[model samples]
Target: MDAYDLHSGNGNNLSGYANAQIDGIISALAVSADPAERARLLAEAAPVLWDEMPTLPLYRQQRTLLMSTKMYAVSRNPTRWGAGWNMDRWALAR
Candidate 1:
């Protein structure tokens, strides 16, 4: 909920939304060491976040890759570096 957090928005929250409850929840999550408490805080925040709809994106990021079945050692990097990150290790199938 970084986008929803008032302090953590980092310009990602296009709507400029702010919620005290959400902010408190996120703050608690940050310092919370107990797994159960963290889980509860997250669970409590879900409904509030959904109902708020602070900044819903019009499009989700989708990564697409096309590879031949005959190809082997194809790198499937999912980051912005792209799939050819390990090109040096790539080789064709026998």
Candidate 2:
């Protein structure tokens, strides 16, 4: 599929073109009931854009937060938000 990212305005995350090419295979994998068939189609579609991605992985940064004895509801992997983004569940130890 040919991916395009117009919103980023810098052209980073678009895969529409590549997506178009393998859309059938993706759709088949989605609706396929048989596990073997699903695996087969997934295997068939995974390599369509091998070594062709615009962006490459570099490194993973570890996030660490030291909270006091009262903090809670912290997410393990807060990709879209901060570690303590969900503060509704926070409580203090009496």
Candidate 3:
């Protein structure tokens, strides 16, 4: 589970949920019209926000499993653009 601490200015009272950091981040991001400002707020709040009391972080989980027989090459890097991406290929034994 992912979580973040909350601050009074971040607004954790309205939701009534014990953990509402994701809401706070969305609210902060929504309040800003500028892309740079939105990014700035996200970066600033990431360290101190979560689902307890004041801050909350949205939880994201990535899962993967692989099976192969003759495959000899595969890439699992998330940043790769083409076949090197997580979906590209899988290593297998011949």
TM-score of each: 0.50, 0.44, 0.28
In the range 1-94, model 2's lDDT, one tens digit per residue, is 1222311232544532445545577556557799999888767755764644434447656678777766555545435345666666767676
Badly placed stretches (over 4 Å) of model 1 are 1-12, 57-94
Best-performing candidate as measured by lDDT? 1
In candidate 3, position 26 carries an lDDT of 59
lDDT (tens digit, per residue) of candidate 3 on 1-94: 2222222233534443443455567567657789999888778665655323342436655656354646666645443234446544555575
Pull out the clashing pairs in model 3.
Answer: 4-49, 4-50, 5-49, 5-55, 6-54, 6-55, 19-51, 21-56, 50-55, 50-56
Order the candidates by TM-score, highest first: 1, 2, 3
Write down the lDDT of every candidate, Cα atoms only.
Answer: 0.72, 0.55, 0.51
Candidate 1 vs. true structure, TM-score: 0.50
Candidate 1 deviation (Cα RMSD)? 5.5
